[model samples]
Target: MKNKGSRRRPNKAAAPRKGEAASDGAGGDRLSKLPDDILLNILERVDTLDALRTCILSKRMLKLPTMLSRFDIDVGNLARHHDAASYGYTLNHVIQYNNAVAGVAEKILSARNLEIPIRKLRLRFYVGRDGCLSISKAFACTMATQRVDNAEFVLLTEKSCLKCTHDNLLYYAQQFNNCLGDYPAAFAGLTHLWLRNMRFGELDIPNVLSTCKRLVSLRLSNCDAGVRSVLHIEHAQLVELCIEEGKFEAVQLNGLPKLQHVNFVGWCCPDPLTFRSVPQLRKLRLEQIGISSTKNLQLSQFLANVPWISDLHLDFRSEKIWVLPESPKLLAPVLGKLQIVNLDNLPEGCDMAWTMFILEAAPSLRELCITVWDDWCKIVTDKEFRRKNGYCEKANVEWQPSDFDLKHKNLVKLTIHGFQPDVIFVRYVRRILEVAVNMGDISLHDRKVCERCMDLDPEIKVCPSRYPRTTEEKDMLKVEITKELGMASHAVIHFRS
Candidate 1:
């Protein structure tokens, strides 16, 4: 018997166990009690090494690393602990980081339970002698022993593209070729690969595509065979391809039966791309800064082979317009299937009527997005730099509306970024209303803010922005638009600040 006012200290043997304590809502390791599937899902989002370190803290989780089916071990993750104050890590720091990544990857791969299949494996490592060899060997062994479904490798050089010389790029490319020779099994098993700051031989890239038989995606950044070298790609399984800042004069898609997506950026050649056989291509994106010598892209002739494209994105990079406006008669055949179009970074003061060519051609177009702004910070403002780089001066694109009657019944939504309360914008909106007869919604948004743009020299003449601010101004503008158009527009106009 126990007194009601006194503490009952008699039933020590009836105390709850740790598991019972957790169930009773007392303090306990609730995370460890979670199911393995839930725990694995939580760990999969983090770096593989960090996940393994977390697992080592609990006895129940100590064996969980071996059961993991995915790994993303990147040397870039180690930069969080580094104290460097530069744009990139130092050479010694990068070397040490690569070694750490290699050690962690090897440990996990070597200790993994072979019964559990690996679904994905991604590794980003520096291209050093010892580190590359160790990493290549570990990945090769994993590919040979495990049932890996997808593998990706992002090889990095010690120096960035801006810091690397021609000799450095050549050296990196040779090292990569050697690595490919040494570890053919790993390359063969890869489904995705990214290489940067490398200048390969004339036939090196073609040979690489031939070796990577199962590759589905390939990205080359700041890498080229040589200046003005023609790159001909013909792959059986490739579905997506991206080339950024490469110096290839022409990239001929000789044959890619399964390819569906292509993205090309920072191209300077007159005619940078040619399509021969890409029957399944559906999405294409091109971004470039227009220069004096760069010829305007003619989509009518350029996309004749791939007419089934449904999604198209063209970024002018706030320079001279690089796309030539063609008649709808010539463009309709190539653009018949186009449904979505994003014309990004058109110069601020250009005549927007030229854009109507797209609306006239793509009869099935349902949504159109246009961004008009001159981002001075991204544009080279220095006269000498612009001259040296062959950048063209900012000027209005000369174009007039064709005499053909325009009527698009499919367009339902129109979005304009960097909308201003000026004649150019108002006129553009009126033209859109006249052409897009079935348009239901028109959204006008203010320009995107850029903190870097504030630091530019005051002398640089940025386009004066006159965005509607007060409610009265907005209502007045709406009234003025309706009054000038002389008809009731069925589209709901929204002015977004």
Candidate 2:
């Protein structure tokens, strides 16, 4: 018999029998019991480093990494301190992190099973010479040995655009150009490439495009040849192109047979883009802060060459309206196939009836989405800053509908963000109801909240917001809207707070 104070010794029989697994609290190793395909699918969705760490938990999972078809290796995912100094690491730390990334990529790519083809592979690392070379060689070896379907490389500079000088950008571009020369095979197999904060030479961009034979998508942020320089892109297999904060005066799509989607942002040129020989183009998005000097765009002339666009998005950045409301007859040929339109960031306290041009132009339009908000945080509030930067003051856009009797049967849904209970908003909705007779749904949403704007000084003048709240308020608003329109509308009205 045991003493009253004595505790029982651990029982050997209660433990797992020899050659059997121990219980994992919930049960015996449930995740390891799952089939290989299901486990691999779960692992593929996470970062490659995390997947590798999970594999270390069990012997069964150790071999799964080698069988994975998709690998996403991003050095940014590495655990680091949250302090301000660690936001962008020092040179030593950056090199260390990149080396670790290169080592892991080499290990995995070298040990991959040759029987399985790589469906997708992505590597994002800092632009370090030795680490880049090692990673490029590993990628080249895998591309030569295995059947790689999609491969992407996202190269980041040591410094961000704000911290980089003109000389720094040129140096970064030269470094990347040297890397391309050293690893032609790796680049030739690349399908997607995203480059940032580099100002290449006049011929450098075209050369890079020509070398990447299989590139399907390319994004250049804060990259350009020079101010007011024209960029002519000609690629055979490219499908998607995005340019952000570039200094190019105009981007000419000279020859891209398979291109379909384009997005241009923060362009200052009068006519920023032109399309040629892009038969498959279907979607376009343009966002800019219009100044007093910027020329207003006319869609009829702007999209004359590319008449196959089905989705168009225009963002005015809440400064000035830069898109002219044109006659529907002039816009019909270009907007014939348009099915969706998103007019984002229109200034508040302005006439919105000018937007009816889209309804009259696109006979095939099925959805129209508009967001009206004047975010104080993004707009310049200081008088001196506004004058120095050439920012135009807020003003109403002048336009009158060419035909008020226009009828649209295809528009089914209308969505308005920043909906206010005011006469202007009510009148705009009534006009849409008059035009779109067969509309089925109208969704009105409150303005998007901006944290920085909330912290701003209370002295800045802005329109008072009166968005409806509570079920009773919404019901009353619906009744008032219907009463103002003086019609028994058939559309379902929803108020999303």
Candidate 3:
């Protein structure tokens, strides 16, 4: 690395001369003294184009870094070439871009032979409809022969999807199918693999899962494919697996003994799980799945086996509700460990007792969200349902919440939707606050008169003037008042003291 520019004058403390002028030719002196290793490191950090330009700077920096163990060849950089269409350059520039990339790739691949024991190799290519199939075949050929420790394949472009009549998109999808034959050997050492928006054809997912023994994490999202074999795992090395929005059937979980987290979304399977397949499973999720029905779902038995589950989100709208047992004792043991529960459109008559079960089982619960049948859960007035027996008033709550709070002291937050809090609801809130001294947050939706400003605030004297402090104005603004309270009730949020 030779110094190209003039250096500054020497400091007064060190390199001062006796008779030579302060502006002596010592300007270039300090830069020449820098070691070769530091300059080489600086040059290696530049982009590949700029790194190649360094060859013009000095003969010594012309050769690429020998110690470089990792290299990424990106075709996106070559795609930036500006060419005028008036000069008869429609696909000509694309051809030039492809040729330039191929030339660079050849040089890099040849260099890899000399840089033996290359740890990581990354190739990212973007191809339009005009990209030659020969080029894709050559790229796949290189990957099969190269050593790739970690790989990411992203095929995302309108050209790749091929909106026009050409077979470009189909060709792109078939490339992955062709690459699968070499996947075992090419990606044997791979620790992480991510494939996104890929149109895959004839890739054996089960074979890939089995062959990639060193794989610890795998993610495939928005892959376009037809019904492939249900993903079966014969390996236990996988720690995390995520499959979302693709074509696949029942995923066999038998082989993943060490698997901790598994996410399967939009996976249309008649049965999502088989017995004892995932014993070590910690988190299981099924969202927006197309299950024909929820009849005879052995839900409790399944929950009993998955004791480590701390969060469960299941959207079972495809199945009928009210089929399961409705007592706390039946569900509390399994649900006791649950920290978050989200249920939508629960069958009628499922709300009142289901809430009690939650309060019992998940005492450590921080948040509870439930959709209830408002028309059915009537508010039994205070005059009714008095404890007739020797049992204390706390023993019986006709939808009273104080009883719920006494046991679930840690219950800090509640979210209720579609439940109109009549007199019963108000008492429930009062009791819930009693137990939750820290008084967590609450959210209510689709309520009619939960806001105090609508009706209760007039009685409380908070907003007396504009909000119809008078009785007649309050009657005229009854609807607004009702809307406000309903919103507040839906949230069940604790109000200011």
Local accuracy of candidate 1 as per-residue lDDT tens digits, 281-323: 9999999988887898999999999899999999999998999
Q: Report model 3's TM-score to 2 decimal places.
A: 0.50
Q: What is the lDDT of candidate 1?
A: 0.87
Tens digits of per-residue lDDT for model 2 on 259-365?
99999998868898999999999999999998888899999999999988999999988889999999888999999999999999999888898888888888999
* Cα misplacement distance, residue 448 of candidate 2 (Å): 1.3
The segments of candidate 2 whose C-alpha lies over 4 angstroms from its true place after superposition are 1-29, 79-85, 457-464, 484-491
- Residue 432 in candidate 2, Cα distance off native in Å: 0.7
Rank by lDDT, descending? 2, 1, 3
lDDT-best of 1 and 2: 2
After aligning candidate 3 to the native by TM-score, how far in Å is the CA of 301 from where it should be? 4.3
In order of listing, the candidates' clash counts read 0, 0, 15
Q: RMSD, model 1, all Cα superposed?
A: 4.0
lDDT of 1 at 32: 76
Range of the 10 consecutive residues with the lowest summed lDDT in candidate 1: 482-491
TM-score winner: 2
Higher lDDT: candidate 1 or 3? 1
